[model samples]
Target chain A: MTLSPEELKNFLIELIRTAETRLPVDVYEALKQAYEVEDNPIAKQHLGAILRNSELAAKLGKPICQDTGTPVFYAEMGADFPLRSEFYDIAREAVREATKLVPLRPNAVDPFKKKNTGDNTGRFVPWFEVEIVPGSDLKVTFVAKGGGSEAPSTLRMGLPIRGVRNVWETVLQAIVEAGPKPCPPVIVGVGVAALSDQAMALAKRAALLRPIGDRHPDPEIARLEEEMLKAVNELGIGVHGFGGKVTALDLHIEYAHRHPATYAVAVATNCWAMRRATGYITSEGKWEIISKHITG
Target chain B: MTNVYHLRTPLSEKDVRKLRVGDTVYLSGLIFTARDAAHRKILDLINHGEKLPFDPRGLAVYHVGPVVRRKNGEWEVIAAGPTTSARLEPVEHEFIAKTGVRMIIGKGGMGAKTAEACKKYGAVYAVFTGGAAVLAAQAIKRVVDVYWLDELGIPEAVWLFEVEEFGPLTVTIDATGKNLYDEILERAKRKAQEILSRLS
Candidate 1:
């Protein structure tokens, strides 16, 4: 049976609102760790305040940070999904209502004019990527990516010989150079593959992975994550780059087939506040909360 | 009593040398706001030998693109945080020399050339607190006068604000080659390496 438009719209709005209000569990863990290791009194104090703010926001159902961020939606719809025809439009409407109900900060600005739309919806807003698989359920992931971390996100073109070592060095340089601007301690998502753009996209996708500290299915990638995390923290760009032992809470890498001569690496840094919400819609048009970390 | 100093409208080399790095000074004076585009315009004007809207000598320039508010038919500043100053590094020296400005107020630190020019010209670079836009607005008592650069837009225009006791910024880049930001970064880097080694 086809899902009612109103029900789908409400789910989308709820997802966006929750994404804006809550800092993901992994991001919260990273920030707490950063606060623990921060040496600079001022930076440490700032991190504490941010942590408290996040807690208060979650408790009171308020936006975690002032920069509500641009809404990003990722959908995996089953081939048998009944709402497939109207999914995209429902997502857009949800974002529009979310802009008002959530009171999300007006982040979408006209590139050339630099004028804010004030509703967080503009060209290509609620950016969505849809995948169709054989199933009767629909999976929707909503992420509100902030500008602070996005500003320092990097894509590098590495020589074939450089391989993972080059990826490590480049990420180290990015974190070192980023200092406190990207709002550390940060969770770094690394995308490795043949194309820079696709790799960058995959890096963002990796950000949504569950925060299973020190656990990786791939031993090599897992080892690389551990090594990179240690190296990055050692940079002493501690909490907010204020000089600390814990600069990164964790590192997640997503890999793809690459061209023999090209090693495309993309690093997307997620701030202490990684706002994300995910849910699944079953074939019967019933919503199932797969993973909800809003109260944290 | 509030510390008030009737400094000249535009500060000069001699004026700048008299001030220290951490001194809080009330500039009841005329100052201009210019970031990327306005700096370009100022440079072009200098190149073309055209007259500037305001005199540059001994003047203080704030690096800000304020979110303007309107109330009762008058425009006012709501939040006027300092933008990252390094973006204007390429044009700072030229703007300083040609305009003969004495002081630069911004957030974060500026480049070496700008610091050098400030030292040579007897100027100073001050840093207002980053993310403290609301507090900064309270110091701006009035608009006094405004020259709206209608074309270049809010951030890149030359905004002339009449401020009263408008500062609590530290001297990150002083007149005598003492750069506090550089020192902080270096110390942080060393400490970072030490922390990393311990972890490894």
Candidate 2:
């Protein structure tokens, strides 16, 4: 059955508003852990304040950090879904309204002019990466990606010989260099594939899929994630890069077949305020809230 | 009560020399906001032997791009958090020398050349609190004037703020070669290693 535009729009608005204010469960857990291990009294104290802030924000239904971030939606639509056109348009409209309602710090600025749109919509805002599945339902994941962590994201083009060790080393170096800049303890997403841009995309996609502290399916990747975690924390760029044992809360790696001669590695860091939410729309046009973490 | 110093209009080498690390300075008068892009443009002007938009000598340059709020046709600063100062390392020394800026206010620590410039030029680099945007905004009582570099964009333009008491910053890179950020970073590294070993 076709979904009513109003129903879809309401759901989209709720999702956007919720994503604006809340920290995802996984991100909250990582921040808590970072607070426990932080050694520098000042940094540790600040982290504690941040934790309290997150908790309060979640409870109050307020945006966790000042930078509410650009709204991004990843949709898994079914071939049988009747209201395909209505879905995307509803989502975009919801984002535009939510930008003002949530008072989300207007992040989308005119890239060339660097002027704030004040509505958080500019060129290519609310980026959607869509995939069609077999079922008669649609699953959409909304991510509020912040700028602080996004600034330090890196992509490295390496020879095939570089292998996993190269990836580990490169990641560690990147984290060490990033130091307090990205506002750790961060969630690092590693994308490995043949194409550099594709790999970077995969890395970001990986960030949305995994829960905080979850490991990769492959034992090798899981092990590397652990090792890299330890190495990065060793840099002593603790919570907020002050000094701590929890520089990274989780490392999610997404890999694809690489060209025989080349390996492209991409790293995306998600800050402490990992604002993300997910919802599923069924064939009957009713939206199911799979997960939500909405703060004031 | 916190000691408040009313520093003069254009701070010179002599004025900067009197300042000490860890001393709180309540700068009145004029200061310019110059981040990555503005720095590049200012350096280009210096390179071309062209007149700069503002006098640099005895000037305080803040490394910030504030989110502005407009009310009744006047622009007010909302949150003016300091941008990463290290990004300006490429042309910091030259910018300081050519511009004759006496003080640099930013978050995080700058590099050795900046420290060297501060030492040689008798200037100081003050570090405002990172992530404390609201507090920074309070320091800005009014926007005296703005020279919009419309072509360069939000981050590129040098916006001048008339600050009431614009600082509670630690002098990380002082005129005497004492680098607080380096000390903090080194200590953090050692402490982090110890904690990581336990976790592993």
Candidate 3:
């Protein structure tokens, strides 16, 4: 059976609502753990406040952050899925509806005109990147990219001769410069090896995709993730950039093979409120929203 | 050491002068909101010899563009979290000097100039935990008025609010010219250099 356009739009609308209001369970748990162990009194209080804020937003049915963020959707659809032609339109429609219903701050502006779109829908907004999979099901991950976190993302080309350590150094420098700006304790997503644009994209996706505390499958990458997290936490930036024991809740590193000439490194940071959610649409058009902490 | 303060708005040099880096302050009474556009507009109004919509002496300016929802014909704050203050660095020193704003609330550290202005103007730079929008909104008692809503739009408008215990704000830059961020980054840079050397 083909997925109806109306069903797809409604599913996406619900998906946006849940993603905005709820903090994923895993993210919340990591934050709680950080709050429990944080030695600095100032940092500890900040964490407590964050947890309380999330609880309040959920209870009141409000957007978790005032900056509801730009809704970025990543979708994977089975090639056999019949709605390929209409999917993009439905996604944009869902976002427009969510902006009104959730009353998302009108965030989209015409860059050149400097005009607020009023509906949070503008040129190329509700950006979607799709990958066609081999299956018959549709999976979508929604990332609400906040201005504060996105402000600190960086892309740089490290000299090939300098090797992987250069990538690490760059990532460290970026995080240090970002210091308390991207909001802490933040999750760092490092994307290595791809070209500049692709590397940044991968880093952003990694920031939103990987569950907090989950490491890369490859042992080497996993080891790097562990090392980076330790180094970052040691920076003493702490929660909200006030000095603390836990500067970062976790570090995620994802890599792609690159041209032999350059090793491009990109770091994407997400604030303590890791605002993301994943939804699946079945062939029968059933909508399933999964936030690992909330559902799993 | 950290100190907690229950300070009211229309703050004086004496009130802000006592605040030091790392001190926690819960600001009460009136606070105004402004972002990039509102900042520029205020500057323009000052230049054109027009009176500001609100009094600036001893005012606490929060750098935010809040999401406000209308309920029962009145505006209610949905999420009123702080925005990055660094973006205001270009004009902030002048803003403080010209307007006499005694306290600045936002996330991210302001620059050296702003810190210097804080000292010279007897002001303080405080950080409200970023992303704690819902929590921040609860402190706001009500929206008193707004300016430049049609001109600069909702998020960029200058919104005046009466608030109570409106912060878990850390005074990152205190009136005595001490900046918490500068100190933290100094130690951070030194420590980072040591780590990088070991790695290399």
Query: How many angstroms is residue A79 displaced in model 2 relative to the true structure, after the best TM-score fit?
Result: 3.2
Using lDDT as the measure, name the better of candidate 1 and candidate 3: 3
Alpha-carbon lDDT, every model? 0.70, 0.72, 0.88
What TM-score does structure 2 among the candidates reach?
0.75
For A1-296, candidate 2 gives per-residue lDDT tens digits of: 56777777777787776765666766776667766766665456556656666666566555665556678888898988877877767777888888656655566777677576767776788788889899888888888887777878889997788577557655765676677677677788889999988988988987665778788888988887787776666676666554547777878888999999889988888776677888887777788768745342
* Tens-digit lDDT string for candidate 2 (B1-200): 12335575487677767666555566777788987778887888789888876676777898876666467999766556566678888888888888888889875568889989989887888765454455566667788766655655454568888776765555556778566557647765564445444542
Going through the candidates in order, their DockQ values are 0.12, 0.15, 0.82
Deviation from native of the Cα of residue A173 in model 2, angstroms: 2.1
Q: Judging by TM-score against the true structure, name the best candidate.
A: 3
Per residue, candidate 3 scores C-alpha lDDT tens digits across B142-183 of 999999899999999999999999989989999988888888
* lDDT by residue for model 3 (A1-296), tens: 56798999998888888888888888899999998898888888888889998888878878889999988889999787767778888888899999989878989998889999987777888888899999777899988889898998998998888888877788789888998899888888988874898888888877888998798999988998898889988888788777888888889988889889979999999988777889888777877886653421
The 10 consecutive residues of candidate 3 chain B with the worst lDDT sum are B186-195
Question: Evaluated on chain B only, what are the TM-scores of all the candidate structures, in order?
Answer: 0.88, 0.88, 0.97
lDDT of 1: 0.70
Model 1 clashing residue pairs (backbone):
A234-B196, A236-B192, B10-B58, B10-B59, B11-B58, B11-B59, B12-B58
